[model samples]
Target: MLRTITIGSCVSVQGLLVGQMADGKVMVRVDEKTYVGYPIPSKRAA
Candidate 1:
């Protein structure tokens, strides 16, 4: 699955879902690199 995460206040990344951290952060891989950050909340259907 693909997920989007925010690394900084203005920086966001979208990549393949790697794993989830214990502190509520999530891991995502872009190309050969992996990044850990807070996942963006998905919008609910209205």
Candidate 2:
């Protein structure tokens, strides 16, 4: 699955879902590199 995460405050990344950390951060791989950040909340339709 693909997920989007925020790096700092303004930086955001979207890539393949790697794994989730115990600190509430998630990891994602864009190409050959992987990044860990806070996952963005998905919007739900009501």
Candidate 3:
């Protein structure tokens, strides 16, 4: 599944969901690189 995460306070990235951290952070892979960050909440359409 594809997941979106925030790198810091300003940067957001979307990539394939790789794994989940024990601290609730998410790991994702974009291309050949992997990143760990807090997962952003998905917005529901009204």
Evaluated with lDDT, which candidate comes out highest? 2
User: What is the per-residue lDDT of model 1 for residues 1-46, given as tens digits with 9 covering 90 to 100?
Assistant: 9999999899999999999999999999999999999999999999
> For residues 1-32, could you state the per-residue lDDT of candidate 2 as single tens digits?
99999999999999999999999999999999
Off by over 4 Å in 2: none
Which regions of candidate 3 are displaced past 4 Å?
A: none
TM-score of 1: 0.94
TM-score of 2: 0.96
Superposed Cα RMSD, model 1: 0.6
lDDT value for model 2: 0.99
lDDT of 3: 0.97
Better of 2 and 3 by lDDT: 2
Query: After best superposition, candidate 2 residue 1: deviation in angstroms?
Result: 0.4
For residue 45, model 2's alpha carbon misses the true position, in angstroms, by 0.7
lDDT of model 2 at position 38? 100
Worst 10 residues of 3 by lDDT: 4-13
